[model samples]
Target: MNKTILLNNRPNGKPQESDFKFTDSDIPVVNNGEVLLKTKYVSVDPYMRGRMSDAESYIEPFQLNKPINSGIIAEVIESKNDSFTKGDFVSGMLDWKEQQTHNGKDLLKVDADKAPLSAYLGILGMTGLTAYHGLTEIGKPKEGETIVVSGAAGAVGSTVGQIGKILGCRVIGIAGSDEKVDMLKSKYGFDAAINYKTTEDMTKAIADATPKGVDVYYDNVGGTISDAVHANINRFGRIVVCGAISLYNSTSLPTGPRIEPILIKKSVLMQGFIVNNFSDKFPEGMDQLSQWLKAGKLDFSETIVEGFDNIPNAFLDLFEGKNKGKMIVKV
Candidate 1:
């Protein structure tokens, strides 16, 4: 039997374990050109919170009473296609199940020897691609500039900060906890880190860290921290608005910063991006990230919960900032 997590009810705010139900079903069989996959790991991202709501967004809402969907790393148990064989490792958008069937064309075989299978759900997957495109295409970070990233301890934010360092820019990370702040500096090599929870004045912390002013802001959590960064932006600074994890489960609308005037005065450019926009450049981005990983210039981390039944809790943790790096469920 295959176990799956089903959305039992829509969440009003922070999701509780009761809102989801675990069910057991027969393992799906593969047809021609299809592969049967046994899931190894599943990614839990902040963006999934938006999907929980029926409200309109870039992606379609998850249907009620249906198995939750996410990116998963799986090992092929059976294959009907010549391109893939039994025991092959692969990654793709798959249902939240212990085992499932997928078309071989839709699944990308993973090179386990090059990187861990979990990396496909994080550093080499959508999260890593998002950081690469958001920082380069939207933020346009330059050498000697200062770049600020929110949600700094998570998958995308950590990648953004390290890329900024590689680009010869000073990187500042904003996290929710002191432990995350410490990891940002010690593990990710962030130039500076601010624990937003302890800091009374966000604007002061950012100003003190980047005396030259922020040249780029990679916003993963849009709220007070983003407003604070906006207040200290330098001339011609660029801001990339990515996921707003801070506002995802908010019962009320998050207040915006009264810094529109600053945007004009500093000639700042702020833009939001969805990584799919750069799908054409994915190969190029992957090649570069792979090279960096091989050269030991890039690092990645994952907070893995062991069980397919734990997917909901893993996703809920993102809203509470409970993860230090990429959150993954080991199925």
Candidate 2:
């Protein structure tokens, strides 16, 4: 039997285990031009929360009682397609099922010898590309400038901070705990990291951390933390709005301190973008990230949860800050 998960319900706010339904069916058979795939690693990202809702967005919402899909690494156990062979590993947006069949249109072949199969779902995949493109294209950091990252311990945020450091910027990170803060500085090479949960005056904390003023703000968590960063943003600064995990679960519209006045006064440039916006440059970004990884200049972290049944809980753990970097489930 092939195990599968479906969107049991549209989550009201924070997603619970009940929102996902587990079921089993026969393994799909390989037909001409199709390949049978066995899931290897599944990725859980904060952005997926938005897709759980029925509201229209950049991507279509998962239909009620239908399978939920995300980035997945799978092995071609049986192949009928000429482009794929048995034993080949691939990565693509795939449904949450232990086994499935596809025509192999969007799947990209990945080499385990080059990088771990799981890394293809993270540091070498969309997560890494999001960080690379968002920073270089929107944040546009310069040497000697200070770059601040919110959600600094998670997959994209952590990568954003490291990329900022590579660009010669002083990187400051805002995280939920001291442990994550230390990991930011010691593991990812962030210049400074603040535990926002412990800090009382966030604006003051940001101001102190970036004495030279914040030139680029890579925002992953929005809300008060972002407001604080804006308060310390320098003239002609740039803000890359990659995500708003802090506000993803809000039942209603979120209100915060006005940012227009600050933006106008400082001539700041703030832009929100998705990874697909720079799809044309993915090869370039991936090449650079791979080169950095090979040179030992780039490092990645992961909180791997074993078993396919744990995928739902692992996803919920993202909101609770349970993972240090990319969260992956080994199936």
Candidate 3:
């Protein structure tokens, strides 16, 4: 029997694990041009929050009583497609099931030896590309400039900070816990890190960390932290608005200080983008990320929850700030 997780109901505010229901089904049969996959790892990302609601967004909402899907790394157990062979590893945005039958054209066959199979769901995959395209295209960080990243301990933010360091910028990270703060400074090569959950004055904390004023702001967690960043932005600063994990669970629209004044005063350029906006450049991004990974310039790590049943709790953990990096479920 194959177990799949489905969204049982729409969340009211903060999402609970009970919102997900597990259904047991028979393994899907492969058709011509299709391959049967057994999931090895599934990515649980923050962006899925937007898909859960019926509200308008770039992506369509997930249908009720259906399986929720994200990136997953799987192995081809049976192949009807000539392009894929049994035992080949592949990655794709397929259903949230233990076994799936997917068209071969929709999957990218990944080299298990080139990088760990799990890295396909993290650094060498969507998260890394999101950081790269957002930083290079929108944020436009320059050498010797001060860059600050919010939610700096998580998947996208962690990669953003390290890539900033590689580009010769001073990077400061704001996270929730002291442990994450230490990881940012010591392991992720951030110049300074602040634990916002304990900080008395976030504005002052940010100012203290980036003494030169923030030149590039890669925003992941928004709200008060964004207010502070806008208040202290350098002249002609650039802001790449990424995920707002801070406001994802809000039932009502979140209200905060207006930012137009700072935008005008600093001549800041603020842009919001999704990773697929640069889909044409994915190969280019992946090549650079792969080279960097081989050269030890980029580090990819994960906090994996074992078993298919834990997927929903792992997804909810993103709201709780429980994940250290890319959160995945191993089945």
Candidate 4:
């Protein structure tokens, strides 16, 4: 039997656990070129929220009453595929289920001995790749430049800031809580961090932290915090617009104070990208990230939730800013 979660309902604004349905079914028999897998760890990301809606977007929305899927770490229980054998660890796009029978070509065999299994679903996987592309390709940070990353406590943001430090940039992280601020500064080695939730006069706070002005902006939370970053941007700034999690739950199109004047004034270059946009460069990015992790120039954190029953709650908590780094569900 396999337990799976389905998208039971669509959300109007902020989602609830009621939007998901948990049920059980038989694990399918594997055919040639297919491998049967046992679910290990599943990642819950802000982009998954976009998939819940029926709107037209870069990726198709999750259909109602169907299995919800994302990046998952799994173990092969049976293999009819020549590329895989029983007991091999794998990571790929798989459903929120206890088990899966997938085409071998769709999954990548993971090196559990090289890195922790959960890492393949996070820091060494899609999340890490996102940071690499966002920083190097778009938000090009030169030495001594002040780079600001919003949502700096989350998985991708943390990685971006670390990479900024590696490139000799002064990194400033903006997170929701004081504790996350501390973690960003103390644990992640960010030059400075701001507690967006507690800070009054956000412009002044960021100004105080980056007196040189923000030369690179790795935007994650796009809303008022982004507005604050623009208020202190430097000339020829590079802005990488990644996930706009702050407005993910907005029922209507978000209207805000315009930022065009700021961009023109600073000659800022702003680009919005999905990780898939840089697929051709993935192997290169992964190799660099792996080497950094091994050399201890990089680090990661995870707020792991136990049990399949908690998956929905874990995902919902992301919008509320509950997790410190990558949020994963261990089944």
Leading candidate by TM-score: 2
* lDDT of model 1, residue 321: 75
For model 4, state the Cα shift of residue 15 in Å: 0.7
Better of 1 and 2 by lDDT: 2
In the range 1-331, model 3's lDDT, one tens digit per residue, is: 9998888888888888778888998877788988899999999999998888889999988888999999999999999999999999999998899998988777898998888889999998999999999999999888999999999999999999999999999999999999999998888889999999999899998888888999999999888988888888999999999978889888789889988888898799999999999999999999988888899888865899998888888998888889998999998
In candidate 4, what residue range of length 10 has the lowest lDDT sum?
Answer: 100-109
Per-residue lDDT, model 2, residue 327, is: 98
Residue 260 displacement (Å), model 3 = 0.4
Ranked candidates, highest lDDT first: 2, 4, 3, 1
Query: Please, what is the whole-model Cα lDDT of each candidate in the order they appear?
Result: 0.89, 0.95, 0.91, 0.93
Q: How do the residues 1-331 of candidate 2 rate in per-residue lDDT, one tens digit apiece?
A: 9999999999999999999999999877778999999999999999999999999899999888999999999999999999999999999999999999999999999999999999998899999999999999999888989999999999999999988888898999999999999999999999999999999999999999999999999999999999999999999999999999999999999888999999999999999999999999999999999999999888999999999999999999999999999999999
Candidate 3 to truth, TM? 0.98
> Which of the predicted structures, 2 or 4, would earn the higher lDDT when compared with the native?
2
Best by lDDT: 2
Residue-wise C-alpha lDDT for candidate 1, range 156-237, written one tens digit per residue: 9999999999999999999988899989999989999999999999999999999999999999988888889998999999
lDDT of 3: 0.91
Candidate 4 ranges with C-alpha deviation above 4 Å:
none
Against the hidden reference, what TM-scores do the models get? 0.97, 0.99, 0.98, 0.98
Between candidates 2 and 3, the one scoring higher on TM-score is 2
